[model samples]
Target: MAATKERALEAAVELLGTDGVRALSHARVDERAGLPAGSTSNWFRTRRALLGGIIDWMAEQERADFSPALLERPTPETIIEGLCTVFLLETGPFAARTRARYALFLELAADDELLAPLSRQRREFERWTDRLVTEAGIPDPVPAARTIMALGDGLVLHRLTVDPELDARPVIERAVRALAASVG
Candidate 1:
């Protein structure tokens, strides 16, 4: 049962990423998940509930991907590597998940209610980045963190959509190194 729910959510996310929010329906999710008909509706009775579940699932996946261990060491090398790993989407599953997340973000831009959780998640991530910059002895952590985040978002979006062939590691690493050096 738990597995079925997870599969349905995963399928929903994939659909959102590939086909946008309008394509998301209980039947569609069931079909994408390869579950029995009405399975998604059984799990998530309403479209709102289904979207909320997707958001929760995305948050969980992101928490795992950006584990504390990854951010424990705030050295420029670690930061650069971490940023590269996340923005580059070197893995297939991670890339797909990220694409879905970006798609959801666009859809949620005008939806304050749906964007609330994601907004909190964004603030949390910024706080983490600020802490990392402070630990690195950067005098102005806030601006540095914001800059890093902007650079990361730009790179990730570009990599995901604009130019799939664009190589992001070197660019991200160089930017992080420069930002750290400027403040050091």
Candidate 2:
């Protein structure tokens, strides 16, 4: 039963990533998950409930995937590299999940009720970035953090469609350095 729920959420992520929000449905999730026809409905009961489950599932996956050691790095370069490594899907492991997250973000923008989790995530990221930038002795930590995050978002979005083959490490390093210098 637990495995069934896990497979349903994983299917939701894959469907959202590949087919966009409009393609999500209990039947589709069930089909994708290879579960019985009513499995997703049995678990989620309603569209809203299913969506909430997906959001919760995403948050849990992200928390599990994140590395706390990345946050403890003392140098800005190392910190930025660690951050970019996740954003760029450098190991090719998180590519689908990352794309699904972006797709969910777009969907969240249009639905106010679904925005809370994403909003909290964004605020948490901003806070973390602000702390990191401040530790680096950068001036205007808030603005610097915002700029760095925006750069990362733009790069990820662009990479998703424009050039999946592009190496993002060098680009991310240069951008982080330039932004850090600007605030220094």
Candidate 3:
């Protein structure tokens, strides 16, 4: 049962990411997952349920990819390196997941009920960033964290949608250095 659901969600991610929200449906997921008829619907009765499951699954996948050790003792260099690595993954190897996430971000923007779970993960990340910057000696850690997160998100979006080959390391380094300088 769990395996079936996992396959369904994985297929749903690929479908939603590669083809956009319009391409998502129980039949498509079932076909893509190679499950029998009605299998997807058995697990997810509605489109909303399927979407929510995908959101949770994606959050889990991303969390697993992001190791806590990377930012354990955040410094400007570590932060820049971490962000650059994340940028590369998001725009390259993990582009499909990024696209799926952005699709959900837009599709669920007006639906608070559906958006809440997605936003929860983002909030936790922001809190983590807050702690990271604080540990790095940023006096105004909260806003700095937000700025950093926003900048990273924007850069990833641009890389995914605008240019797949954009090298964002220099931009990330400059930004991190500026943030660090603000403290000194």
Candidate 4:
């Protein structure tokens, strides 16, 4: 079951990341994941179920990677900027394939059934930012963190929809600087 489920996730991420996820299918996933045919349904019972499982598991993986404890650095601004840096670094050439995969992961949000998990993940990330905002003794930290999230989201949207070539570093740096100034 574990192996099968893992394969399903690998397949889903692969499909969703490539081809805009509009073409994600069990057969295609099986080929991409190198799993036996019908394994996705064997584990998730349905397409939505499979997508949800992967989404949830990925959230857990990310939460583990970027735990609140990862912010042991003294300054909230530095910590927040460091967090963005991770995203910036991760989306570079080394992770281009994975970024493509992430594009597919996010496409699930368009489906109401699949969107539930995505929303939950987004909220969890926002709460982490909200906590930093509160701890930093900044005004309207929730909104501040939310704006950052929105900017990041917009950047991703732009990358996915408009221009994959557009550089997001400058804008991210600007926002982080502005937010830091606000908090300081």
Identify the candidate with maximal TM-score: 3
**Pairs clashing within candidate 2:** none
| RMSD (Å) per prediction | 1.8, 1.9, 1.4, 3.5
Which of the predicted structures, 2 or 3, would earn the higher lDDT when compared with the native? 3
lDDT of 3 by residue, 42-111 (tens): 9889998888888999999888888667778898888998899888888877888889999998988999
Q: In each prediction, how many residue pairs overlap at the backbone (N, C-alpha, C within less than 3 A)?
A: 0, 0, 0, 2
Comparing candidate 1 with candidate 4, which one achieves the higher lDDT?
A: 1
Q: Which residue runs does candidate 2 get wrong by more than 4 Å?
A: none
lDDT of 4 at 154: 77
lDDT (C-alpha, whole model) for all candidates? 0.81, 0.79, 0.88, 0.66
Candidate 1 residue spans exceeding 4 A from truth: 90-92
User: Worst 10-residue stretch by lDDT in candidate 4?
Assistant: 92-101
For all predicted structures, in order, the TM-scores are 0.92, 0.90, 0.95, 0.77
Cα lDDT of candidate 4 equals: 0.66
**Candidates by lDDT, descending order:** 3, 1, 2, 4
Task: Write model 2 residue lDDT over 1-184, tens digit each, in one string.
Answer: 9999999999998898878888999999999999999999998999888988998888778767764557785457866777677775622676667777777788778888887887777677777778888887667778877888887777777778887776777777887777767733
Which candidate wins on lDDT?
Answer: 3
Model 2: per-residue Cα lDDT at residue 93 = 71
**Candidate 1 or 4, higher TM-score?**
1
Please, what are the lDDT tens digits per residue for candidate 1 over residues 114-173?
A: 888888888888988888888876656789889989988887777677887777778877
